[model samples]
Target chain A: MSNMPTESQHARGQTEPSHGAVRTHVISFAIMIVLTVVAFVMVGAGMAPWIVVPVILALAVIQVGLQLYDFMHLNQRGHSFPAFFITSGALLGLIFIVVLVLWP
Target chain B: MEAQPRLVNAADRMELGLETSTLEGRNKVLGFWVFLGGECALFASLFATYLTLRGQTLNGPTAKELFHLPLVGVATLFLLTSSLTGVLGINAMHQGRRRSLLRWLGVTVLLGLAFLAVQVVEFITYVGEGFGFSTSAFSSAFYALVGFHGGHVAFGVIWISILMLQLKKSGITARKAPKVFIASLYWHFVDVVWVFIFTVVYLMGIMGI
Candidate 1:
């Protein structure tokens, strides 16, 4: 085990402070909050359904992407299997929704 | 050029995070991800059901009449903030800061509890307003989808609380790190689901579509 290269050596340069990570998370949080507020305001303002619906749905998708990639660490290295699993599941789920909703 | 030595010291092991330091730990993380995938599909089916039947109020209160934007907006803030705190706990775990991890996880549990409390109140209000689960197809679907998400949040709160106790006892080790990491992933997944719920159910419902 001692002779094998560690992931940290290859991926992370050194044992640095977690401030950078904290900053990244805080920034993500800010962006999510802004997206959420925008969605809420658009709806509360009684905008046309045609414009509000698709836009809020898009915002939701963006927020979920941020949660998955940033908060869940899917962007990190050595996560190919995890990524594949989630993406496939999401794709299947999307198909289910579309097919089921459009059936009638 | 000479090859660099590949000796993994304690610091390296710590930096790699005990969760992925060993084959077992790595497998545990992978398996949890698979489980999350299954959960995603499960929730999606519920979402589909809800979307299909959302307009069948059948004399009961419509979603626009039933849902209060301010309450739901507050609940979203709680869950969203909880998600951030949960990740911070994981970050602290990676840093080997046990106390920080505990503190952040504790805050997460509180936020989760707050979210649940808000949900309980919201449900009560709905029931009082004749929006019971059996009132109509729309109500049934709404409760099923939203209730399931609430159940996940409840489970996450309990799960993280128990993990906190274990961490306090055994400290953060390879065996426990994966457990903590997996729980956080589940929490984040729950939050992700809520994003859709708020958008599709609450926001759109308010729009009367």
Candidate 2:
């Protein structure tokens, strides 16, 4: 309820993004591309469909986590709600789909 | 004469409407996130449909039979790069660098277009091989999942363009901040969905379907 914008507000304007954050974004992108290529190779290799599904899904989930946490700053103060909602929704979605897939 | 000067200033202030709007900014970000959540559900339904009819390829080319890893790999690279560029767009905006922001956004949009182009070609390749959407449950699921994602990317490109225009007109005031913020969130969400799409639609398809 202050009349003036505070130091925190000023800091937001002055603070520079860290090298680590930038590095993380770059590395994550590289990893996603590499994993995508690997997935393609695995699919091309004629491996059992079961094996490929899990590996590709695992990588995809990893990539999604990186995008949310690293790039989108979903971990920041105001964004916690969206982050929680999105993660919970994804989990619920997976459960719903799995149950349907496995149900007789 | 002095009173007349004050009157003109008041008129100018009225015309400019110096009070910045906050509702559009806040709602746009929150609303877009909500929309993305619904999108997750939408894709979930499509995935379910795909799983249910996974094996019915109608004597057409199945995932293992028709999916080309190299082509999918190329498309994935393009999309992944686009996501990175989207982040750069945000970074530019944060620094109040409009030109840099637009440049990065332009790169992201182009990459998205390229991804869509590749997808169209891929679909054509599949159809050329007699793997039409109606041929079997497998093809149906495949097309449904991929098509849903492709539609999203198309929408996102249009959306970002509008945002760019808004930013140009208004600059990055607090009102515009949320729009850019939400669009970035939407862009990342699109990327997240692609992660799953890559796995379930492309990678898994090649394994056996």
- Per-residue lDDT over B93-116 for candidate 1, one digit per residue giving the tens place of the 0 to 100 score: 988899999999999999999999
Listed per model, the TM-scores of chain A against the true chain A are 0.84, 0.74
Query: In model 1, where do residues sit more than 4 Å from their true spots?
Result: A1-17, B1-16
- Name the best candidate (by lDDT): 1
For model 1 the local lDDT of residue A77 reads: 60
For residues A10-97, write the lDDT of model 2, one tens digit per residue.
2333344444655777887888777777777776777887777778778777778888887776654455456666776777788768
- Candidate 2: tens digits of C-alpha lDDT, residues B103-150: 898899999999999999999988998988888878877888889889
Alpha-carbon interface RMSD for all candidates, in angstroms: 4.1, 9.1
| Top candidate (DockQ) | 1
The residue-level lDDT of candidate 2 at A36 comes to 73
